[model samples]
Target: MDAFYASVEQLDHPEWRGKPLVVGGNEARGVVAAASYEARKFGIHSAMSSALAAKKCPHLIFARPRFERYKEISLQIRDIFYEYTDLVEPLSLDEAFLDVTENKVGLKSAILIARQIRAKIKEKTGLNASAGVSYNKFLAKTASDLNKPNGQAVILPEEAEAFLEKLPIGKFFGIGKVTAEKMQKLGIHNGKDLKEYSLQFLTKKFGKSGLHYYNIVRGIHLSEVQPHRVRKSLSAENTFEKDLISLQEMEAHFYPIFEEVVRRIEKSGIKGRTVTVKIKFSDFSQQTRSKTLEQYPNADQLWEVGLELLRQEEIPKPVRLLGLGISNLNLTEEQVYFGEQLKIPFHISNGKG
Candidate 1:
């Protein structure tokens, strides 16, 4: 899907077509959740402050995010993918990875599967989707973005090495601003330059991720596209409009986000033992503190534990962003602890001795 939220808004409200539409908060302290391509031409982008976007393009029409509608459409699109293959991994409401290598439709080519999937999506949902077909996950992901607004690109296995060699390091998976800057410092501006560094050296510098970087440069990724990627944790982090120095003021900001997380947990039927608090200073330095409970916690328990962790933080510097997360899940029937607790006698293994 292209400009998913905004596109949906435009489709439902025909008046917004071809005009710059933004889906986000229109208030004083709101951020852009998604921006239409027309808005993009004005240097407006998603995740940007709504205030800043307004400054960039005063005529930008802002609409509040409709997550429920997006989820409904996502389900419809997912069903279409299932018709072709069961190997569908959703990245978000609009983007997904489908492994059509051995499709249920008995399609010999992934490109044909992509085309059929796109056609079904447009017919069912009245939205356009772009697709990428490649031998590996990384290449396929890159190819998908090569064309947009109902486009398709394919990277054959024979062309993988040459294709990657000429690509910039910034275009590589997981290479964000921080990593790109680090690579540039080491004279690695592109894949060809990155190939100069040995796996041992990269691993020594970047720990476990260095090995992945080395393989990525050589077009040698073997990661599987798993559909059942269980979410270990759920969190919400926000960057403030103004830096917060006082703990009282910070807690006030966190109160709503805390409530939202609890609401999400209750709605999703998720429970976990760990509560983590993440803090970022004005200088861009970050720190995290967490507590593990002996038993899983509900909504009230989450607030009690989360607030305790927040109170323990001694603000070394003005805070820029704060996040709260729950993890260390135990969702099994035994772990749910509905039955009575039992004590069993232990028996030694005499046969082994």
Candidate 2:
């Protein structure tokens, strides 16, 4: 999906086509949920403050998110994926990983399957999708982003190492701004530089994550494409138009957000034992408070915990954003409680965050 939420808005509202458009709250503190290519040309992007985006592009059109429509289209795309392979790991509503090592249609060429999938998605949904075909997840994911809307990129196994070596460390998956800075300071600026370190050295430097970097830089990601990936948590958050200055004002905002979270939990039919409250100060500094309950909390119970967490925080600075989430999921009674802690990061909108 290309500029998914913004594109959807354009599709439904013909007048918005070819114009710079954004899908999110058009308020002072609101963050961008998604931006169209037209908007991107002006340096607008997701997670950027809406006020900043407007400043970047004065004529930017804003549309409120229609998640039900997005989810409907997503399901249609997923159905297309199922036509070829059952091994589809959905990273989000719009993106997924498919293993075509052995496909339903018995296609020997993964590239061909990828093209077919993209074609079918366009044909069925009247939308474009990009694809990447590779032997492993890392290469496949990286390749997909190399191309834009309605494009495909394939990285052959033989070309993988040379390709990766030339790529910057910042471009590699899992290497965020903070991690990239650390890598640059250590003279690890590219895949080649990353490969220069031994597994022991990487592990000692980065703890458990270093081992992951070691394998991926060598084009050695062995993780399987899991179709039945369990969802960990669901949450919703909002950026205030005006900074919330007091606990009472903050609590007013929490009520609607809590209702939204509860609505999603009920819809998903999943329950969680942990509740977390996230706050972003006006200065952009953020903190989260969480509590693991003895039992899975219902909507009311979760709200009670969230309120408690909010009361504990000292509001020295005004709050720019507030979020609440439930995690420590349980699928069934017979399923062992893995005690796996999952954090549901706040999305700026209903669809993608």
Candidate 3:
């Protein structure tokens, strides 16, 4: 599912196809949730400010997000996955890790399974999919992006070492922009550079994450594909067109977001004991406050807690965004939460899938 939300918009509205399109946001405010490849030519991308996106491409067309449609397509794709193997670990609405080692159809080549899956997806949904075939999740996830829109690539186990050596540190799955910069300042620039540091040295420098970095660069990720992973948390947030100036104003905006959270909680039939509120100031600073209770709180109580957190502090500047979420879920720890950005395939897992 390449450029998923934007692609869906293009699919349902034929005239929009092959043209610059975006989902969510407006020229005046909000953020680009997804951008079509045509839009990408102008350097528009997800999380970029809408004002900047419009500045980049004055002709850019913005569509309000239709999450229900995206979820419908995602479920259709997942049904196709279940046909191949029950060992499907969905990383997001558009991408998943499929352990097809002993698939229902008995296909030995993970590459073929990946292709057939992509073909079925295209056939059924009228949208394209890409796949990355490899022995483990890290390389497979990495390889999935090598080709764009309706393409697939593979990485044999033997080639992973050489491939990783040349990979940029910033491209590593678990590492982020700030951490990658920190690594660069330490004279670590790529997988090869990262491999030079000892585990003890890395742990001392990065705490628990040091071990993760040390192993991933060496192609040693041990986490298995968790097919039954539960969602860890659910949250909703919105950026303002204009800065909100008062506590009364903040509470007014806050209720709808909390309503969304409740809507989802009821839809999923999942409950959590924690309520968290997030505030982003106009200056680009952010804060989050959480309250954990003995049981799941009702809407009124959650709203009360949300308002309490919003008023607990006096702001130095007006707010640009408001958010609310819940955690301490009843589900087990084996879980993967949906992300703003994510991917992958695999008839392969590190083990027998």
Every model's TM-score: 0.85, 0.90, 0.91
Give the clashing residue pairs of candidate 2, or none: none
List clashing residue pairs in candidate 1. none
The superposed Cα distance between candidate 2 and the true structure at residue 334, in angstroms, equals 12
Clashing pairs in 3: none
Model 2 spans > 4 angstroms off: 298-300, 333-353
**Native-referenced Cα lDDT, model 3:** 0.84
lDDT of each: 0.80, 0.83, 0.84
The alpha-carbon deviation from the true structure for residue 307 of candidate 1, after best TM-score superposition, in angstroms, is 1.2
After TM-score superposition, the amount by which residue 61's alpha carbon in candidate 2 deviates from its true location, in angstroms, is 1.2
Off by over 4 Å in 3: 332-353
Worst ten in a row by lDDT for model 2: 335-344
